[model samples]
Target chain A: MEKAIEVKDLRKSFKSAAVLKGVDFEVKRGEIFALLGSNGAGKTTIVKILATLLKPDGGTATVNGFDVAAHSENVRQSISLTGQFAAVDEILTGRENLIMIAKLRHLKNPRQVAADLLKRFGLVDAADRRASTYSGGMRRRLDIAMSLIGKPQLIFLDEPTTGLDPEARIEVWNVVKELANSGTTVFLTTQYLEEAEQLADQIAILHEGRIIVSGTLEELKKLFPPAKVEYVEKQPSLEELFLALIGKKEEK
Target chain B: METTKKHFLSDIGVMLGRSMRHITRSMDTIITVCITPIAMMLLFVYVLGGAIQAGTDNYVNYLLPGILLMAIASGIAYTAFRLFMDMQSGIFERFHSMPIARSAVLWGHVLTSLVSNAISVIVIILVALIMGFRSSAGIVSWLAVAGILALVTLALTWIAVIPGLTAKSIDGASAFSYPLIFLPFISSAFVPTDSMPTVVRAFAENQPVTSIVDAIRALLSNQPVGSEIWIALAWCLGILIVAYLLAMLVYKRKAL
Candidate 1:
């Protein structure tokens, strides 16, 4: 498999404080590679560097075979980024936002591209409504749709479902899954462990600005021991029962 | 849409549309921009008109140019403020990730400021015309006035983008424009610099505002502009080139 992204000793520091300290990682093409970290763990910083939004102070990164610094535009052409929060222009309608990005990307039929993305994202109904009026999920869907204007080979979604309700979060998850299933490489960063488990084919846990662990789910499960160890106890807490019933629907 | 060579121009159009939408939604900035110039025009014409010896037949026309400059200076501050908010909001970061040109972002806003300031200028001119201020200058001179104003507006806009991008707080982003708004008062706007103290006159006559105000006054009155038009264009172009280079440098280094 081809490497979709590669980072070597990437270091970024704001002032005297370091955010990314000699980090290294890689993502294979056509895989959903999830980055799991807490807030301020430099997950977003890494994403920014890979997306060419922020330049790393030290070390180098490449995306889709283009160096982020030397060949920035080529890297830019191969990737799309959806930030932690929806960056949709509230003043523009959902359809306009999509078409605007399409035009920016120099697509031949911008309106048609926008309409197709809107329909695929299940946003056809709210197409003409101003994005400010849309729900958080709708705006986020529009943001992702905008990212797809150029049909990027790689997509970076930084905490894409952070503020959504449960149902809306699932909607985003489904969209992400579909993108990966269609051969697009997705680099996702989220604080939710369940989200990583649901979406990631290759999981990497970042701690204190470094990837402490990276492996497939089953490999990680073997290293950490069973998250739920089976026991023959006669009683269990109500919280455990509730967790089993409602917390993870597909973990079983 | 054609050749991506003109991508910057189209980006300006899109940015103008978005910025106008924001301004229309929040009418406070436009209202504030209009209020300052109109209030100053009224105060200068009604209260200070008789006392200040401008030597011009119509003080409103003479004062109109100054007030228009003040309006433009004050108006672009909101552009800085809005851009600052968009920067803080991560919208800029989102745009940067795409294949769009970086310069287009600022141009979008600079053009927006130009358009909105033009409207404010028109409103102020209309109000002044209604109050016995008339310009007999031909269409060519009017076009010259527009060209100068556009250059001035673009220069200040590039200057404003620096503070907007570099400022940490909302107040900090907009605070730099306060001095620009007050710059007109010390120039030939309110009174001729030679009538003031030697030091004050030195500062006033040498600044960009004096040349700009004098050029506009000459254009409106159909008088010989002498060297003031060239001086004004030089000042505007100088500021524009320098500010654009600096703003781009500041932008290139920004963490966004």
Candidate 2:
């Protein structure tokens, strides 16, 4: 089968600044491929190019077997983008936002599609409420639900949980995992190492516009010097501590 | 090509429906757009009307056209503000990445501006009627006024798209309309240009707003609309073409 995404020496620049320089990567179908990088590492530039929202300055990128540059409409037809910020329309009710996307995608029975997504995403109770009143987690879920309206072959989530609370971040993680389980290829970018470790089937670390390393979690782990066995107490991470406290509070 | 064209219009309709919902849900935007122009009409007719000589019996009659133009100017600022919000919120990017026609996203906002501005114009006209403004014009003339107002709204909305697409801040997005809102004041919208000094009068007579205001005022009064209507159309079409080109250019560069 053809790959979900393919890139070869993709290059892009803004003004005189080179944001993406000779980048290369491939994503297999039905897997969560996480592109890990710090801010300004060109992860977003690559995603934008593949999503057909931008034109590459040089080289080539293909999404779902269509050239992103030459066949941008076909590329768009195969992919959906959930940008860094939750793209839900604040003034629109969550249901309306989903329906709007369905209509734009030329789906039949938009209302039914919206209703089904609302139930699946656990947003039925908030369906009629304006998205402005939603919490961060609810808004992100709504954004993801909107993106799923047309059921594109691939989805690009750029920094999906950058500013989310720990619980919201976990909620997004579960949603991503659920997407992969259902056989959708997900291309995601993040600065969180734990995010890549937890959800990615394949991981690529982007450093200064170049992929320095690409592998599965275990493969990347082998790149580090062999670990000498040591007996040390492990402290709970802040995320674990926060979740525990929140879980206790909820139980009460 | 056939399917693409069909999707282009349908996609614009869908996008327009979305923004129209925004306009309807927040009726306050419509009221806010009307308040300034309506308030100016009230202030001028009641307080300043006795002193100002606009060569008309009812000051509101002389003032209605300019007020309509001003309302449209203020109304399109909301278009800019909404577009800026979309750009900031990433919804714009989401739409761009979709398979729908790329230009539909913009046409949606532009059409919304026209409809919302039309609503504001009608409301102000009702207020003018209540303020003792009357017109002798028949139905054809009334339709002409509607057509001109629609054209003016389309032109200004396209101009608003420029700042909407490129503004660095919310303030910058809407600030472009301030001068537009103030433009009618210096034209024949307020008082007759015959009473003014040369330089200001020269500007008042030569500017686009004056011809538009004069043409609308003539149509409403059932007077001869000779060259003024043509000049107004020329101005509107000229601005519409130039603004449409520039806005599309900006959108292409920004999106790509």
Candidate 3:
């Protein structure tokens, strides 16, 4: 498989503190590669460098075969970054936000493109309302929709599900899965281990500005000793229970 | 190179549209921009008009140019505030990653400031007209007044960009405009510089605001602008070029 992102000995320092310490990793094209770590683990720094938003202090990163440092614009053209924040303009309506991105991308039919994305993202009902009125899930959906304007081959989701309720998180997960299934590469970072397990084709654990280990999920699991498989009856999770209870109360 | 240039213009257009929507939604920014200068204009024309003894009989005419400058200086604080909000909200990071030209984002805010400030200027002039202000200069000279105001707005808007990028707090982003708002008082905007103390007169005569105020006042009354027009142009252009370069430098550091 072709590599979508390749980084070697990436290094960055902010003043006296180093944020990325010679980190190295690679992500295959059309795969969801999750960089899992705790807070302050340099996941965002790595994403920023790969997205061409920040320059590394030392070493090299290439995305979609373009050197991030030397051919920053070429790298930028192939990638989209959904930052930790939703990054939507609060005063503009959801449709307006999509149109702005579409127009900026120089789409031939920006209005149609915006309308299509709104429908695909299930935001048509709220399309004309100011984005400030959007729930966290709606805002995240819009942010992802904006990133899809130019049909970039590679997308970065930096802590995309942070602070979201489980249902909203599942909605975003479904969108991400659909993107990958349709042949788009996704590089995701999250503090939650389950999020990585749920979405990543390959997983890398970042700690203290370094990738401690990285491999395909099966390969990573194989490194552990084999144990007897066991099964137990599963009850619905808390999230499912909460939804069921809420539905019952509303019906009554 | 051609595509980059093309993208730059279009990206600026899109960004301008986005910022203008914010302005339309929040009428408070426009209202605040006009209120401060209009209040000052009223105070000077009514209370301080007779005591100050400006050369002209109608203090509104004499003071209109100064108040207009104050309006512009105050107006650009919103530019900084808006830019600061974008930075805080992470939209700048999003824009940086896109294929669009980097400078286009700053140009968006700068152009928005220019348009909004121009509106505020026209509104102040209309209010002054109601208060018995008159201008005898022909259309060409009136165009000259507009040209100067545009230059002044461009220069100050670039200055505001620096704080908008570097400031840590909302107050810090906007507080830089206080000195700018006070600058007109020291100039010949309200009272003639010659009437001031020697040191004050020297400073007021040498400052950019005084040249701008004097040039506009001359053009409004059909008086010979003489060297003040050139001086005003030089000040405006000089500040504009320097601020643009500096703002770009800070922006590159912040964004990159």
User: What is the C-alpha lDDT profile of model 2 across A198-223, one tens digit per residue?
Assistant: 99999999998899999999999999
lDDT of each: 0.87, 0.93, 0.93
Clash pairs, candidate 3, are none
**Interface RMSD, in order shown:** 3.0, 1.2, 1.0
lDDT of 3 by residue, B1-256 (tens): 3565777888898989989888888888888999999999889988888798777788899999999999999999999999999999988888999988889999999999998999889888999999999989999999999999999999999999999999999999999999999999999998988889999999999999999999999999999999999999999999999999999999998877
What are the per-model DockQ values?
0.49, 0.79, 0.79
lDDT of 1 at B195: 91
Worst 10 residues of 3 chain B by lDDT: B1-10
Question: Candidate 2 residues B88-146, lDDT tens each?
Answer: 99999999998877788999999999999999999999989988999999999999999
Model 2 residue B94 CA deviation in Å = 0.4
lDDT digits (tens) for residues A122-174 of candidate 1: 99999999898999888888888888778899999999999897778888999
Model 2 chain A worst lDDT window (10 residues): A71-80
Error of 3 at B247 (Å): 0.5
Model 1 whole-model lDDT (C-alpha atoms): 0.87
**Every model's TM-score:** 0.91, 0.97, 0.97
Candidate 2 has which clashing residue pairs, if any?
none
Q: Judge candidate 2 at residue A138 and give its lDDT.
A: 96
